[model samples]
Target: MTAPTARIAGEESARDQGLARGVGLWSFTFSILNGVVGAGIVALPASMAAAAGGYAPFAYLAVALVMAAVVVCFAEGGSRVPTSGGAYGTVEAAFGKGAGFLAGIYMWLASVLACGGIAAALCDALGALVPALAGVGPRLAILLLILGGISWINVRSAGLAAGVIAWGTVIKLVPLGLFVAVGGLALLVGHDPAPAAVAPQGGHFSEAMLLALFAFCGMETPLGASGEVADPTRTVPRATILAMLCVLVLYVAIQVVAQGLLGAALAGSAEPLADGMRQISPALGLVLLAGGILSRFVWIGSDVLGAPRVLFAFARDGMLPAWLGAAHPRFATPHIAIWVHSAIAFALAATGTFTRLAILSTLATAGLYFLACAAALVLRRRGVAILGTPLSFRILPLAAGMGMASMVVLVAIARIDEILAFVGLTFASLALYAVMRPRIARAA
Candidate 1:
């Protein structure tokens, strides 16, 4: 028993050593930025304006405050687990395989759906640019090219993927920065900043928050690649906190500029940011439209870099076939995993509308966050050791509880159909876990 156990442990260590730790603090921070600031910033301004009139920015603020606590919980979990499965690893460590598997599905689905939703949005922007290509044929072709190309890059190298994301972040932010600077200046000069509509009434505020939450939801998916991160305990929390801060500030600024510039017309504009930019210059408005398209392309690249690792991790840990976990000897990356998920994402992007996919992804991520917060308390109580230097701030229970409560509230207020789909997925995960339990134990 001792000899066999030693041999088994050795094999597991060999498997664990497969992935590269190419993602450092800055790279990981950029990953967080790349992950969070995708199509949400590009396309949601009008939706937000419609939901809350001029008060839309406050809804973003409201959600951010609650999500901040959730981020702390995740930061703590990331430090402790610091593995590829990310939230899956943290949750599994606290509970059992069954619970971990369920959380993993949520993490994986959230990434795929978000990527698909953004992909659809990208095509929509393209359609706007070239009305001739607005038909389904062109949209499908575009998604194929972007998804196929980006997934190839990911299969080749994690470092290469990170580089793409890091640079992509700067490129996408340019138009947004210009809009805020130029639009904000114009507003100050002689702008009528009053909103034509009143504060969010009826269920409008609730709806506003749902959109705001989507803007914030994609940030956490990158944490699924914690194993690729160098010195995760040092890197994860710092990078996550900094990126989340940037997201909050940037989102608020964009909302303010768009609102003040467009005023009463903000809600009615299909292209709020573009319209606001056009008020100053038509050429600038075109830039914003092009920026939206570029943002989605970059976002899909980031999704490939970070999300497929969840599949690789699952395969590595024996939750699924070992082939899914197998790193390509030539590239030292999870090529099979990347390809498999890319295919699924493409299909979803082809079939689903942006709004439907965004709502589904948001609800999935919120549920995942709620579970992770609960896992944080369990991990602390179980004395899960930090993978590197300990955090300076204490992991307060109040914060964990608040995060959990916030997620519950988020899910509770979403459309009933979305809630039902979430529940259905949860049950499906449990059923699959039970069936796979024997294989899981054998792998363990």
Candidate 2:
């Protein structure tokens, strides 16, 4: 006999109540792009250059391909589940409550760390533009202000948040596109570095690939927003694929421009794209800097809006404190979860460095992705229909599984500290899960 149909709890339904489906194809595409690109593309070229020399662009393409493989796996999982917990929910079904609980905790921590990093980066960009606020107090204040503003907007309405994200994405892309065009022209004129500048040295592909992985880190945010979409199964997969494609194009284009202009020098510069533009035309430097700052707003907004919804999802499932599932009665958003996540993010921003936090976040998130891919394979093998529903893409589950496994290998070899931290955190979560299991089982 078929298993019982899964029902969303009263609280989960409350949080989702009156939440109009404002995200269509373009809005969904914009949200995904805004969520994925963030501030990474601005910094990634230099990071890749340090490792792969000129072949950095190829490294990005390779990373994108690997991520795409993972995305396909996610698409299948999402098509089946289409819930807010995203990887947490998917892994739970494939593995068990214990493993699923651990995955949820890691994903929550990753989102908190990542949101903090993004906010701090935005504050840094603002400080750069307005040097008078170089003092610690002013910068901290600015960070809080930005975070508070984003939280307020997100808490207001999902539709409003989508519009902000969609517009912010357009604003961010325009300057990057201009830089690529101008830089390409300069290279053709022999006014910039030769193609040899971007060519990889004898043995640095692995390092370059790791840096490229950073650029593709936030591609999963759209999945987190599935509940807010009109038809999640269709929109989620399309948004995931479309967003990945947009990011891949923007990243590869930026790398080509940066490398063609400054070559190895691009790797050394703190602001590689801006520096490349400066080489071509000083005026373009200002434009690129402005663009970076604008892009951070989109990142901050998307993170604040998306991350809390995941928390709410977990809470509704009794995996987290019940209070976290509280929604804004009128706004139809997870206001309590938003505030809780914001508090954690603010604390992390005040304390952690970007590099350190990013490493930790990437590891945790990658672990979840790895599990999600595995779940797809497991479910397909067991012939388990997700959400008591049929699924498309039978081969996707296996591809996602292999892709995730390969990423784990890469992370182990390249980011050993992150891997260790993730494992430690996971074990700690497992201990908590063991204690909570009896309670969760009783609730079920």
Candidate 3:
């Protein structure tokens, strides 16, 4: 048989032609950090404390423990396929082109809607940062610059974009890191009275865990750049695991510090992190204000690096127009795909219509994770490996099983509107798949 990594007889791998394979272990990890640790981190402690009490950190830890299993499936899929595909190449390997096509579009649609919502939020954030940008003309300019700039960078080079995400990660982390460090110090010196025992509340723990799930939601985002990652067979797995652990540690520490410093008041403060930092010193608190802005900014940048690759991946597989998968000769990047994705987001941001589709967010996340875990089980059982050789991970079966159960929990807790949104999107996507499958087979 031909080597597993080989493509179609005529079509070439993007990496073989112009797609730069330059993203390394740490940079991809940074991309993950930037993606997962968004603006929500700053505001999360207050709600978590209210719901889970001092056990707030434990609730987040509980979610992370479950996520560890889920990332294993992602790790295996990415290692086996090692391509720039949606979810992971293991999906198509398990389910074939038709189902794979559905999964691919499913994720791409979510990204498009998410990008629009994020873009609008970014504009509002920038407006808050610079009062001068509040006018329609100024806000429009901000949107253009933000979206256009990120697209230009990604189109130019995935490596360059990774570098930007690295700095963006640090820029946002400073305030959060400060909050943890200073707050911990405050406790040490008895600058604040000892925090009350925040024992876990069983009745509310489940609610808190589900809410905490969003903080861990972006693990799959950076994997979209499978085509550009260097040593992906090992790199993807390591980054996925490490980035998650780091976030879990960081989140738990921040929660502990906030709980110790703010105590009962933490459960009520709307701006817990910012307020906590302010208590240390006014200047530090002011810096935390910029934290939210920087966090969202980096998230949008990381999102640009991620979600477009599915578009490029589909086009490369002949499920979409080939032009989208074409790599830029000079930059070795998917410029066309990047531009097109950005355009959809820009339109959505400008019109403010992406909100209608926003309800799909939770359901879309559940579907994607379920598909990935299912793919992992199928691919492992089929003994499939598409990357010439697969890394040996002894925990595949156990991890995948647990991942599926975690997904079940996610779906079990989803609200009714989310279920409706999921059903609507599924029917619509399957109908489109039916119409397109025949043409693709005829072409083949």
Candidate 4:
């Protein structure tokens, strides 16, 4: 007999209470884009320049190609499962409940830590505008306020949250677009691109590819929102691919423009994109700064929106407390889970432990991506066709293999402290899993 299928418990409640299947293709695409391109994009070109020197833009493209394969694997898994837990659901469907639990917890923890970083960045942005907000008390207050605002937006409805995300996407790109247009004009008028003296090498190129991978970290947002989409199997794959393509173009453009203008100083500048724009015009840099702040809002909001759904998925599947899976009677949203996520993120951001946790967060993200790809490969080998159709390239196994290799490289490149931390978390989670094994087995 085939393996048992694990499912969440609240499908009818979701429909009756308030969740609707109305997200269109455009909305879903922009939502994923919002998740993938955040304030991180503003800072990436600099770090990439540090790692890969003058060929930094090429690093972005190489990693994008690798990540695109990973996306295809996730797309296949999502098309099969198309549930809230996303990678969690897909892995469990192919592997078992045990594997699913690990994936879910890993993703949830990573998202919480990432939210802390975003909150801190937002506070810094606020502090830049209002110097008095730099105090610990005021910073914490503002962080809590922003976190609360995001929770409120997500708790009400997914549609409203998606709309906010879509609008934010449009607004955040305006400054970047302006910079690119002007920078291109300058280049056409005999301005030299890449005035930097550093040259690229193989070792640095690999390191840069690894660094750029994190920039694409949130590409799984569409998978997380699958349950709310109107034709998830079709919409998910299309949206994921399109979002990746758009982001790839944006990342390369930003890197090229920033590197050309900043030259030798690109790697040292904290605000590379803004600095490059400043060279063109100081006023343009200010606009890019504003856009950078706005971009943080978009991604942080997307994180708050997506992270809770992972817990909701687990709770519904009987992997965690059922209360977490409960949809609000009136709102039809997972309000409890959302609040819990917001609370944890707020606490981490307030205490500043989130920075330490960020390394583990990257490891966990890589783990989840690897597991999802493996699941897709396993399902394919087992003759399962849950993803509906093969990818246009008809290379599911190849894509999965490439994704797995990338994850290995990422893990290998992780710092010693991050590896130790990841190992410790893995063992602790294993112990917890042993205790929950009976429950998981029964649910399955």
Candidate 5:
């Protein structure tokens, strides 16, 4: 009996170890969804209005289409490798270790910068709801506190971190869905805003469209967690596509409702959706605003889960410290990597400029996506099998590449400073890589 019990425990331990390498399919889907629909949605209407005028809905649709293309490209690449590092791993495999190191650094910096943006946004929302902490000093302190709390959750355990993200995502989605449904109902009841209220003005289509694209950033977060997913090939693709579709529907519907409810006002308002909902029901507006704050928490949680996995993957490949590649003995999670990510995220959140951070983060991610699509083309041309699957570079990869390239161009036109920031950050990454290469190789 004792021998049989020991055998059972050993088998269970092995199973746990294997499972720790990836998460279940539903968990993967939820993680992706959580990553895609963050605090940006709260700011979407304002960004769209700034670019597209009243035609924010159309801009959203266009953004969704572009995002879909990117999603398809990610699906192809992610399905092939399904590793923790995502774009870094794919690019490394397609190119070489040097390129992989650069890609991983870019992605890591992006994730950390994103964490700062999310933390700032969360603090802003909290300050708005609590007037006592509305001052800059208090808000910054609150932001630090929030970052600390989130970091603690992340380092505690993978399941706990993922569970937090999963639940937070669901909670945030409910209000967004409600806003869409209620807004659609209002439109059906002949409460639609005037066409002038929803149409783009002065032919600023390109600018508005680019801003919309920005709103759809983070759609490929699931790929970052591919290493932790149960079935990377099937689950990563399905989860990526599904998360994007969900975000698209919610974004478009929300835009339509917001435009109808506030018209040109939606374009100018910082909290457009909340303001629009206020027009419908002040109580609901408050509720949605509260939800937006919670959504930021969800975003942070998802980032904490996803970013460390990328580091872990890079570490495994000798691009970083091998110790970072160590999985938890009991939990089978990347505990060390998680702590390192949280520490960096906390430092950035505590001190970084939000605008600069946001721009750098977005640009870095966009650049990586562009490279992933290009790599897909390269792999297809070389007749390489991606994860035992046949490689094919169809129109989707080209479209995705072009779309991302256009976005990069548009961002350059609209915000050159941000582009420069991305460039500067890339240079910093390269410097770190140069300094660490020897040590990484020696450790490997």
Candidate 6:
């Protein structure tokens, strides 16, 4: 009996060592892209136009370059650790468990709030298409429906979630790609793209550039699933680079077309992409609306897949309930964590507005970025190595420095309320950690 029990325990341990590792290069790339390119991409041109006029495209370009440094830093740290929890795990490796818990909590809060906002946005987007859903009750119902469906898919299988996100990304890009192609061709044939390239102001450009950062928020998402990724050291970095390039191409093309077609009108329009597409053709406007719905789903799906993994990581570390660490025996997915995250997010969706949650999410994500960058510097200095050959780009220190500086700039630009919310969350995390320390020590 003892021998059989030992064998069973060994088998369970072996299964626990593997997090499915089903995520391939392409799927991983899509995950990063899905994280970075959310529904915000569609109307972002308008916001940029309002803020920077002719310099809006340049703002996008500059922000992308700055964000690249941050991504590189994350890539470096992820390669060294190549585990779940993303910034949380990396920071824990460098700083210690307490720091990791704090980082993980920030990320979890950010994703949960962002998920709520996405659901609310999804409801609004659907309402625009179907007037019947304009009422609060109907919208809330739809939000619940969306969350339920996504949670079901995620709890069933991580591979399925990856597949859905990848295919959803492809689908989401179609309308934007078409607009870019048509608009770019028009520009090539002696047509001026921007009819209103007004002089840009420094103040407006600064604000717009900061706003553009929102479009690139999800670059660290793929890292959250590192345990599930095959050859994470190589795959994570390569996927990060590829996803960035893809978004850069798409963003540049879309911005140019949107700027050219809408000109000054882009600044004030509610549906910027649809307005720009309408200028090309009325039919294209409808395409933009349809695409917006698809993009929202992709955004929510990305968050759903990411946040729960962080919770799973916390549980595995004994920061949360131990059951959350358990993957579904059949599906090998973190079913318990996913359901809990979905439930809380759904509650937020029902009660919260998008603007409030967006502000909080932005601040939380910026905080996470600061920690991730700082961890990169610390880990490299300490010279830690994982079991596998870690990826190295030789610019880790530089990348970390730049990434930290960029995050500081971001934090400075953030609103006062956001800063306050971040501080509050940090305190809350500390309190929770203090209470859980004894239990965690015993578990360890």
Residue-level lDDT of model 2, residues 175-290, one tens digit each, is 77888888888888888462334434425677677667766876566666565776766777887888889888888888888887887677666567777888877889889888
- The estimated TM-scores of all candidates read 0.86, 0.82, 0.77, 0.82, 0.81, 0.83
Least accurate 10 contiguous residues by lDDT in model 1: 4-13
C-alpha lDDT of all candidate models, in order: 0.80, 0.73, 0.73, 0.75, 0.69, 0.76
lDDT of 3 by residue, 1-444 (tens): 243334421132533457788999999988777667776676667667777776778888888878888888888877766666637455765676777776777677766766776677667656655779878898789889989999998988889998987787778888888888888888788867324355334357765776677667766666767768888788888888889889998988888888877777787665677667766787876687678667766777777887788888667656676788899999888889889999988888787622233434544666777788888777666666655566656887888888788867765665676666677888887786677666567656
Best by lDDT: 1
How many backbone collisions does model 6 have? 1
Number of the candidate with higher lDDT, 4 or 6? 6
1-444: candidate 1 lDDT, tens digit per residue: 234323423442353478888888988897787678886677788778777876898899999998888888888877866776667767776676788788888988988988898888887788878888789999889989999999998888789888877787788889888988999899889876534444433237777887788899766667767878887788988999999999999999999888788777777665678878877889999999888787888888877887788888777767877889989999999999999989999998999977678878888888888889888887666656545444534745887889898888888988898899999998987887777678888877
Summarize candidate 4's per-residue lDDT along 203-287 as a digit string, tens digits. 4675676567767787665566576777777887888889989989988888887877888778766567777777778898788
Cand. 4 TM to true fold: 0.82
Q: What is the lDDT of candidate 6?
A: 0.76
The TM-score obtained by model 3 is: 0.77
Name the better of 5 and 6 by lDDT. 6
Estimate the TM-score for candidate 5.
Answer: 0.81
Candidate 6 Cα errors over 4 Å, as ranges: 1-16, 19-27, 152-166, 189-207, 228-233, 321-340, 347-356, 388-394
Displacement of the residue 186 alpha carbon in candidate 2, Å: 2.5
